[model samples]
Target: RALNVILVLQCERRRFLRVGLAVPLLGTVAELREMVAREGHIPPEQVMGGMGGTGKGRDPLRATEVPSAVPQVILAEVSPQGFLRSLGDSEELGAAGEGAPLYAFQPPPARRPGTANPSPLAGNRGLHSLDWLGGQGLPASPGAAQPEAQHPLPSAARSSDCLHRGASSRVLLLLCNTVSDGHRLTRFGPPLVLREERGISWEQLQQSILGQLRALLRAEARAQGMGVPLFRIRLAEGMEPCTYLSPQDPHPLCHPAIDRALQLSGSGGPPHVRLMAEWDLNTKERLFGSVQGEAVEDAESVGLQQQAHRQQPSCTLDECFQLYTKEEQVRGTAG
Candidate 1:
């Protein structure tokens, strides 16, 4: 549950050079600005913008972008990948892009139990192909029925839940490349369905997603190979990102939104692995259908993950059972 806010400082936009920073995402707006100023040596006045890609403006950061006296830097909240993709080259930053990732304010997480620091998950195995993620996309057939996506139900128990209707949920995987600056590439993979007929497996979904994602974000993604790329699954009104961390480590402290998501997913509601990937598709033909990398085999399925999650001490999913309905709460209060 590593929680961090990624910000791209568009210093001198004309030069197309930005310094990306990863800060703790939990602080308040004023606190964050103060923190950034103290740490980055830039006063809060220099930090001007606060934006979230979430359409409805439900983003936590958007609420804090109140008008102020200083030249507030437009501090936009983007994924680490997006921020990295925003940074173009080492020559641009004058430093080797330590893993081509955004620089983080938090110390890196500890590696899996036995591994040394700086080791990539599963031996840093890169995903081999993008074919399974919808077959390089079929030529548009005139009458082909476009896939339907299912909106997720709330975490609370409800008689009208989507799962009760016996329909599978679909999600759009989005991958975006901002390094091109003027000519950015944003690709959407075929919709992935969350089906109940087959046993659910978050592990499999995650691998399939990472396979396609790594495919798009390869070292060769950029002809210049310097910009960072990112992908996420777009839900109805928000974007969910695929989480990366050490294999042996427990999930980074889940964010409140994610904690809610876990509860909803484990509650027999619609569950999806966010698979939004941003990459340059124009020159990715070489990667299309090319399956040649190692993939981790998972014996446990998503159903298993849910069950194990339920068994954990003080798991939020289990805590859902403790919640009382409004009527029940009223009656208890009256009694």
Candidate 2:
């Protein structure tokens, strides 16, 4: 036993993410997500898209890496206008800003129920009938916030004809007031399950979304007593884009700046994360914002994200980005 020197090294068991504060780590993505949701003061369910996204790579969930003693990754919450105001060109992302990109988080496909690797939401605590987004600032159309009322879901036994999965289980129904046919359509989703995995094919995430939409449609059909068989469902255009903020560091020099973003988005900070995004049409609003460069391209993989069908949406759409794109063209032409 020639043990020359015994070193007393302080080790941390739980990996923590350096967000607004130092959050403890959990096993699965679902658990990690809850922490993020709490920090951002968002509804657990409404914290979709990049709720648990690392956002540095192709898969958001996969980006949730093991936490280190020091917060290795920094989650910087940049406002919509600030998002456009990166370390680049003018207020508008012009030809000089052509290379400037905006990023979004998309979860990878999850594995089937019985697979070798566990699902992304392996520890998903499918809390029964819990409206996780109850207190969040979900607007009730025309400057009204949704009343603090718990609209309990019908139990499985009562919802015999309802295709709404997790209705009896732990799922989050996202209420989307999408812009469809030049009008807003109040559509509630395919409930999202807390614990699910993204398999190699990434179909797992798609299945969750598509399956929920079908269930909701089926319930609506039965409620109306409509006898027409359901075929397919597609998200309408002109909806806003939901983007997640991820850290981009070729090396670790930018870690401090990342931390700063987290601080700014945390308590008493800016509107880093939002639910219903409207376009940032005012060029002046983009002032004082920095350029993010390559980090902007992080959202490029969004197209590769898996979904139910080619026409179906993998994530919810708001109205912010649409407004900017549509109005920017008109403004450019007029000016």
Candidate 3:
């Protein structure tokens, strides 16, 4: 019976291990001995009693039947604290150890706001201003048609001496503005206008502008120099709404004029230039709605009061002369 109990407990321990559960050690041994004594194979008192038997010389069979000593097995020597410490050390060593350079293993540091790397164009400052004389043509004017002429516009010229200059030295000026109609203000993209006071021919200006534009757009580094002053105006809003100009989809403020200018310049040929201006009318209110009729009436009353003050007459030159003559006579007698 005792053997049967030991076998049952061993089976339970094996089953626990298989199912990933912890096994109890000393309790299992005690239960096995109790079962053996209950079966009448051995006396319960002898098994239950402490390891030493009664002083009287008991029968050898009874003594041998119940084992005097249980062997001890060392399952594991590690404490919970020691095991945790070992695991932590291994992880720390992997992170900052000599196996890999710390800088190489770590992620790069973030850049500060507005501290981005400088542009390549920083070196090409003077190239922006070099003038190239290309052609003689009619001066640009607003709302005028181009006159028919036989000679084609001249191409830009280049010199061997000025190849190393940067864009800053060449850039004349940059201007930016927004277009709005009282109610709504809309942004417009930058329009770059480059000018050269002297030295470069018209052909050179065209070539330089084209070359610079290609660089700006990140196109091929070199191409035939277009011989004209180039003007690029990008609309703050994209091209779609402005090109269509539908009332259902209102055009962005600056887009209309910018789009028109680009179209005209492409078709009209070289020496392209355009002027942009804003027009305003006091009668037009914000797009949402107009002021009420009563409000307009009140405004008119206030305006009349302002007009009356403006029209009122003042003392004339004759009155001032008479006053001055009386003062002069009194002063002469006193002297």
**Model 3, residue 3: C-alpha shift (Å):** 99
The 0-to-1 C-alpha lDDT of every candidate, in the order given, reads 0.29, 0.23, 0.25
The clash tally of candidate 2 reads 26
For model 3, the local distance difference test gives 0.25
Highest TM-score scorer = 1
Ten-residue region with minimum lDDT total, candidate 1 = 191-200
Each candidate: RMSD to true structure?
23.2, 25.5, 45.5
Model 2: residues >4 Å from true position, as ranges?
Answer: 1-179, 183-187, 190-204, 213-215, 219-335
> How many pairs collide in each candidate, listed in order?
22, 26, 34
Per-model TM-score on C-alpha atoms: 0.20, 0.19, 0.16
Q: Sort the candidates on TM-score, descending order.
A: 1, 2, 3
Estimate the overall C-alpha local distance difference test score of candidate 1.
0.29
Segments of candidate 3 deviating more than 4 angstroms: 1-152, 163-315, 318-335
Write one digit per residue (lDDT tens) for candidate 1, span 264-293.
321111122222333333334433333222
How many Å off is the CA of 267 in candidate 2?
12
> How far off is residue 281 in model 2, in Å?
28
Q: How do the residues 187-276 of candidate 2 rate in per-residue lDDT, one tens digit apiece?
A: 222112222211111122223333333322333222332111111112111123322111111111112222233233322112121122
Residue 226 Cα positional deviation in candidate 1, in Å, after optimal superposition: 16
TM-score of model 3 relative to the true fold?
Answer: 0.16
Best of the candidates, lDDT: 1
lDDT score at residue 214, model 2, on the 0-100 scale: 32
